[model samples]
Target: MRVLYTSIFYLLLPFILLRLLWRSIAAPAYAKRWAERFGFFSALTTHKKVVWLHTVSVGEFLAALPLIRRLQADESVQLVITTTTPTGSERVRATLGDSVVHVYAPYDLPDALARFFKRVKPSLYLVMETELWPNTLAACAKRNIPAVLVNGRLSEKSARGYTRFGALTKPMLQHLSCAAIQNSVDAARFVALGLSGDKVIVTGNIKFDLSLSDDLRAQAATLKSQLSNDGKHLVLIAASTHQGEDEIILDAFAQVRASSFAWARGAVLVLVPRHPERFERVGQLCASRGYSVVRRSEHSWNGASDILLCNTMGELMLMFGASDIAFVGGSLVPNGGHNFIEPAAWGLPLISGEHLFNFAEVARLLTDAGALIKVNSAQTLAEAFVRLLENDSLRVEVGNAALRVALENRGALDKTLLVIADYLRKS
Candidate 1:
């Protein structure tokens, strides 16, 4: 099965490159780093122990930011980081510039993996979440490098997909030195998928262990003031929205603003699309709906703009902190949802759609704690917004719940660091 899979992958390589080229029409960065994907970057020559950490994209990098910083404090290892997407690479460059040796991750082909291993020659590899690749794992095993899966999660939908290719998936998982899973359910899923019980430990989610500086909070306040044009404008942020979700969110925004309540009438909706490629389309979509849109990159958001289109990178945290209500997107249209941890950490009341399978446990915790509100349609979403807007105390109650839940889950970062330290010591 492994050989067959490799052969099939080799056969599909051209089509994959072609697809990247096609996608580059909208996201040009995809076309820029072809050599890096083939593992042709300059080799590291550091005498210190080298550790490589891979994050697929921005969300994972943001989630692992605290952990990455923690590792940086220990100068014994030369930290090398790789991101699969250009946006992710951009984030790594912008946030922790020169702190780690950043590069694009090599493709899953054996040749690319061999080149990557030869260049970096890392002692330990930490891959975030579900970024498991068969060839990558096989290379790590062959090299005797400890590859740990940090903040691991396995949804049932993903489990079924893995079950389909059990032969390939099983050995791929077994190659891991250990998996620091997010929850017991995910840990159980790893065991079912062929990871040894002792090799899988539930370390919770490091996202909950985020560190927000006082400066960031002040920046958030300043942004809120600017968006409101120094007036009293109720801000409702629809964050990380997907393709099919923006329309529904706009409809909800319209409904919310049309309500008889004066607060609703003066509300400003901050729309942030999930991907950079969709930013222009989303802005046009808002304009088509007769809403006055403000692009963050073009100009500052003011009182005249009905929707603040957040097209900038690395500012979602500020947006979350600036808003009174948050609608975490991707859940509305079966995209399995993005992380709601950021907004929750800000003590903001969150609303999401029914499709939260990817974050099932986290959603359940927030919902059970009376922090998260679930909605299925534009009408329900509007009602959720109106309910909180009309009752300030209700918003406060939910927000407090979210903050408490986030604080209660804070030790995950420490646990995750301990696990990494243990593995690094062994290797």
Candidate 2:
């Protein structure tokens, strides 16, 4: 199965290169690092006693940060973090500083994986989330590098696809030395998909351990004071929004502005898109919605502007600190939703769409605790925003509840670190 997978991957190599070329024409940044997939193999050969961690993109890197930090700190480990996206590599560099080596993961071709393993000679390979590449797993197993799936999750959508190719996927998963899952449901999914039950351990979600440095918090406070100098009564933060979600948030903001409540008169909406490619599009969307938009990428925020478009990267946590109420994106349009815990950690009352399978447990806990509002449509979302803005008492109640939920779920980092430590010792 592994050989067949590798052969198919190589057969499509030319088309993949053409796709990269097309993307480069569409977005120059995507094209600039076209050879990054091959660059990993080059870097791997130079590093000794390498411990490679594979993540698909920025979110997974952030989710696996605590584990990365622990591995980097270990004297026996030479940490190598590989991400499939440019944004993920950038984030790993920013977050890990000088602690780990960052590289773009090689494509799952046998030769590429072989070269990467030969160069890095990784003692242990850790994969984040559900990025299970058959060739990569087979190559790691062949090299005798114990591959572990850390903070792993198996979404229903992903499970269906894997089950369709169970002959290939089951053997790949069974090769893993351990599967540190996010929750019991994830463990069951992995077990049903062919992983031994003993190999899958529920470690909870490590995203709850998201750290906000004092410097970052201070910067956010400074930006908040500068942006809301005249004492704006409310700041509605639309965070990690996807395509259509921004439109709904903008409409909700306009409704809040037109409300009869005195506090609604000076409300501001901070719109943040989920990806960098959509920054300009989101800014245009905000402007089209009749908002006087201020772009963060321009390092300019006008206090008089009704909306602030955060066109920057890796600063959502800071924005969360500056927000009064946050609408977590991805949920609004069935994108499975982004992390809501960052805002919750800052005691910001949260709102989201009904679709939150990505962070279902967090959403459930927040909803049960009255820390978050789950709305089904734009009208319901608008009403929730207005209610939170008008009723300061309700905002306070929900905000405190959110803080409590965040605090209660703070130990996942410790548990993940212990698992990585055990792996290192055994290796």
Candidate 3:
């Protein structure tokens, strides 16, 4: 089954490259790192042992940073980080700087994985989240390197997809030294998928262990003042929105503004579409709806604008901090919702659509704590916004509940680090 999987992957390589080329039409960075994707790189001579960690994209890369920093503190560890996307590579460079070596993950062809393994010669290999590659894991196993999957999660939808490839997935999972999953549900799924019970541990979600810099908060304060003209406007942020979501959000925003809520006249919605490719489209959508829109890249916000388009990356957290209410996106359209941790950390009254399988546990915890509200349609979303804005005490109550939820969920990073440290010592 593994051999057949690799053969099919090899045959699809050309199509994959063509798809990358197609994506490059919007994001030119996608076409720029062809060599790194092939595992062709200048050799580095280092006496210290190498530790390789791989992530698929920006979200996983950001989630792994806390763990990466913890490992980097060890004198014997030379960290090498690999990401599958150009955006992830750029983020690693921007955040981690020269502290660790960063590279694009090789295409999972056996030859490419072999070249990467030979060049890096990693002492330990770790993969973040759901990025298990058969050839890469097999290469690590062949080299006798301890490979661990940290911060693991298996959504029901993804589990069903993997179940279809049980023959290949079972053996691929068995190659891992450890599978530190997010919760018992994920652990059960992995065990049912044929990973031995002892190899899987429930380590909790490290995303809960988020760190917000004082500088970022200060920036948010400045932005809030500029956007609201010294707290005169009510700020609502709809973040990480998908295609179908933007239309609903805009409609909801219009409904809220026209409603009898007292703050309706002062309301301003910050629309942040998830993908960069849709930033312009979302801005146009807002304009077509007759709302005065301002882009975040302009670094200028006038209280006059009805909508703020957060077209820039790495500023989502700051924008969340500046808002009075947060509506997490990706749920309205069937794309599983994004991380709610950011808005929760800000202690903002949060709202999302019904679908939230991706961050099920976190969403449940928040909803139970009265920090999150789920809406099914544009009317409900508008109602949620108006209700939260109309009552100051209710907003404060929900916000405080959210803050408590975030506070109570602390220490996952410590647990995760301990597990990885123990594995390193035994290895």
lDDT of 3 by residue, 179-297 (tens): 98999998999999999999988888898898888999899898888877798877999999998999999889989988876686679998888888899988998899999999999
- Each candidate's lDDT (Cα)? 0.92, 0.81, 0.89
Order candidates by lDDT, high to low.
Answer: 1, 3, 2
Each candidate: RMSD = 1.0, 1.8, 1.2
Model 3 superposed RMSD (Cα): 1.2
Candidate 2's clash total is 3
lDDT (tens digit, per residue) of candidate 1 on 1-427: 7789999999999999999999999999999979999999999999878989999999999998999888999889889999999899999999999979999999898999999999999999999999999989999999999989999999999999999999999999989999999999989988998999999889899899997899999999988888766758789999999999999999998998899998888899989999999999999999999999989888766677899899999999999988999999999989899888899999999999999999999999999999999999999999999999989899999999999999898888899899899878877
Q: State the weakest 10-residue window (summed lDDT) of model 2.
A: 39-48
TM-score of 3: 0.98
**TM-scores for all predictions:** 0.98, 0.95, 0.98
Model 3: residues with Cα > 4 Å off, grouped in runs = none
Residue pairs in candidate 1 whose N, alpha carbon or C atoms collide under 3 angstroms: none
Model 2 lDDT vs. the true structure? 0.81
